[model samples]
Target: MTSDTAATAATPAAAKSPRALARARRRHSAVRFWRAYRTHKAGLIGLGTLVVIALAALFAPLLVGADAQSVTDAPGEAMRAPTGEFPLGTDQFGRDLLALLVWGARISLTVGLLAAFLSVAIGTVVGITAGHFRGWYATVIMRVTDWFLVMPTLVLAIALASVMDRSLWTIVVAIGVTTWPTTARLVRAQTLAVESRPYIERAQALGGGHGHIMTRHVLPNVMPLVLAQTTLVISSAILTEATLAFLGLGDPTVVSWGGLLQDAREAGAVSAGDWWYLAPPGIAIAVVALAFTLCGRAVESVLNPRLGVTR
Candidate 1:
């Protein structure tokens, strides 16, 4: 067969095997994303730090050799400074500060991740639906999103948490629901841009269903932004959870970084100048928040260079 004939024959086989084509496309996109990602060194560092924090939180109990909830005074052990045995010292309640911190890390990170995922899921759906439909539906959705945008997120979350039972899941839901408007607006804007492209028009012309076009085309195109937004959401969610915990709205049963801070405050750690009691949790929050912010900025810069974000 001639070269042209061979090429035509392969084209039909290629079209017949969509899974192979899809795998190839995915691999290509992964490579492209990695290339873009490597250009941001700070982002890589932030990602590394984030990973370390996660691992530390996950293995807290094993590393500490004690349950965070365990109270051990053993005669005048309360509020002691760091020693050979207790690296982070003890709280006023005689719980190991290091153990509490480890457990707190787990809770804080879990809340951050779960809340961000929920927020992003809601935002992506609302955004894609509004942007793709573009009519009265879009108008209504946008208006609702705008209403959310106008509301004070922290205040709304505080109100929701105050009304609900204090639990980890409740706090997560409160933060997630309150924080989605920004992601929705961002996704909607990106969806509008993606939908106007020629490929989307061609897909529509080819009789692609709304579901097919959105899931296969528009979502992939806008995912980088969604991912970037999710990272930022995680940071905000963590902060929000901490704030709620500080106000005594945290799950009373669970130990979280915020709860530790609350415990310290109530115990007069600040006034007593007990750095051991006060510093670790505060530093943990700051470090984790900064890591997420750095990673988010890097992803945002790589995916949307038009925003003109610098390192």
Candidate 2:
């Protein structure tokens, strides 16, 4: 009975050892990644900017009351320039520009993140499938990807948005479906390279099924490219969302950076010389896009030192 109890305890500890090792390895990799990431000043700055923006968006309600968003209860005059009473001034609707910006960040960032994730998920799966398989299967997938690649992504997104019910999710889906081809192309190339490695053949020799080989070997090898592409995709997603919103396809009920720009245009902020109304959202969009680009470049450099060296 004592021996059986000891064996049972040992079995659980042995089972836990793999998980504990995996956790330790992940921590070590994260530390290494951070250490390398610290060397890129521009990347660090961009990352800091994103972190600040994310925190502000997350805590927007705490920072500004909901009344700030209420046009009927607006506390300031319409199109007022930045003043002590209202730091960013008021919008055309007499709503506080500062508050609008804070809330807009939440929508913009959420759409960007979710849309990018959807795009990458679809791309990764398609890329893996196309690269892992051969014959007609690979040909069909590649042809479809090529078709999307040749087509104007913005036009596709616009068409999709035009037909859908105007909502946040509609915008996300439009951007996600239209933008995945680029990532698919990228990931397919990486998968092809990974599958060509000797270990993939060894896995095949060991009787690894297609699913096991793809998930365990091909996916892991291609993940670095996927990670790098994700940052770039996010930037594109945000830009697409803004474009759709500017064209009056965005959710009318929600405040977003692009919606603010559209509102500014409708109110004739440019004609009236209300730079305050026009500048904040435009600047925010540009700054966030640039920040994501900077971060993507940094991640690419970290993952592929050869690119860094060439640069």
> Quick one: best TM-score, which candidate?
2
Give me the runs in candidate 2 sitting further than 4 Å from their true place.
Answer: 1-16, 309-311
Q: Estimate each model's TM-score.
A: 0.91, 0.93
Candidate 2 structure quality by residue, lDDT tens digits, 1-311: 99999999888658877779789888999999989988989899889999999999999989887666777898878888999878888998788899999999999999999999999999999999998886799999989999999999999999999999999999999999988988888888888889999998998999999999899999988898999999999999999999899999999999999999999999999899899998999999999999998899999999998896322
lDDT of 2 at 4: 98
Q: Residue 128's C-alpha lDDT in candidate 1?
A: 92
Off by over 4 Å in 1: 1-16, 72-76
Best by lDDT: 2
lDDT of 1 by residue, 1-311 (tens): 69999999888767767788788889998899889888888898899999998898888868765455765533227899998778889999777787788888899999999999999999999999999999999999889999989999999999999999889999999999988988889888989999888988898899999999889998988898899999998999999999899889999888899998899999999999999998999999999999999999998998888876766
Clashing residue pairs, backbone N/CA/C < 3 A, model 2 = none
- Model 2 RMSD in Å is 3.9
Question: What is candidate 1's CA lDDT for residue 305?
Answer: 85
lDDT for every model? 0.89, 0.91
